[model samples]
Target: MQEVPVQRQHVGGSVCLLRLLGGDGHRTVRGFLGGSLLMNCKYWHGDEMKPTFWCKLGTDSDCAADIVITSKNQSMVWRERFSIRDNHAGKLFMVTTEGLAEGDMGTYLCKVQRSTTQREESYGVKVMVSTNTSAAMR
Candidate 1:
């Protein structure tokens, strides 16, 4: 089986959706990531290890963040939590290329965990954050 290939990555702030192509039975994923914090990928139940996705505070503040991710549906799973240390100054998601506006401000988390298998992986919902700018209020 050679239809699918291994995903190669080592760059920071890189986003990818890794998929296993040629393998039988249960599979797992392993790798090291460091920049501001430790990030791990999680999936849904019945599914096994695959790939972990991480989002960090980029191009702003101290290059650090208090970013956290978790599943939106898993009310019982707590191991799917993620964190980004050394959070920078200023408003959150302010310096990021993909960020919020004056009326866009709130909380965001990515919930992911695998079922049956040990590895956790899957996509999550990013909470939309908006702001409000007014002259009289200022």
Candidate 2:
């Protein structure tokens, strides 16, 4: 019998090959004023349930600021404009934004806590918001 090796890439001192598993990588998502957008993150097939958090990347720090939501203890709080939803059967989380505004334009991250001290994160999702109507463009 022959053995096949799985390919891997090191990302922030962690191995992340989820991009090859039908998951999104670093990319930009565009939305228009008064529109909506969805960002997605997937879990490995057998990953133990852990806290999932969505946050906006900070301008001046390695840490993420503007935490959008989290799935710790199966509890969550959402602002009127942002929310996070978990799909257990699909092993993923969807971060949604409604009534988009210019302030919503930025980078976001989806992270999963593997353990008390370990976490895995998806590539950044940059959000771009534009005026949806010609009158608004002026």
Candidate 3:
């Protein structure tokens, strides 16, 4: 992975926008069946007070159907097998998915909702789950 500098700009009074200069906002992750996967998403400093969302990619590639969403004032949110924790000081959030299965293999989106004036920033993640048949056979 290449290292990119974090750019911060004031969109308006008290609102900041963070952008990564030379990187595509997509990632591919592999996990074993019945295990867990963790994804880290970074955002702007001012976005700490904003809401964060984690959702399976909808048919139209939108986050219309969210699996879990964090409150603006809360640091953590959980729903069923999905959980999201926001680290304000670090300007990043972590999403954990438990009980991985074949059905969990798909694209997920992590989004940080900005002020109404600015569009939300989203990161696309592709999850691939596989089973270790050899280990199961043994």
Every model's TM-score = 0.20, 0.67, 0.77
Tens-place lDDT per residue, model 2, 5-66, is: 22233322222111212344455556567766666566666542566667787866344564
lDDT of each: 0.26, 0.57, 0.69
Model 3, which residues run further than 4 Å from truth? 1-22, 133-138
Give the runs in model 1 whose Cα sits over 4 Å from its true position: 1-3, 13-17, 21-23, 33-138
Residue 56's lDDT within candidate 1 is 34
Please, what are the lDDT tens digits per residue for candidate 1 over residues 8-83?
A: 4435432222233323332222222211111222333333222222333234422133343323332222222333
Clashing pairs in 3: none
Top candidate, metric lDDT: 3
Which 10 successive residues of model 2 have the least lDDT summed?
12-21
Cα deviation of 35, candidate 2, in Å:
0.8
Flag regions of model 2 displaced more than 4 Å. 1-25, 75-77, 132-138
The ten-residue window of minimal lDDT in model 3 covers 13-22
Candidate 3 per-residue C-alpha lDDT over 6-121 given as tens digits, one digit per residue, 9 for 90 to 100: 32222221111222221456666666576667777788768888888888886887865888889877889888888999888878787888777899888888788888999887
**Candidate 3: RMSD to truth:** 11.1
Best-matching candidate per TM-score: 3
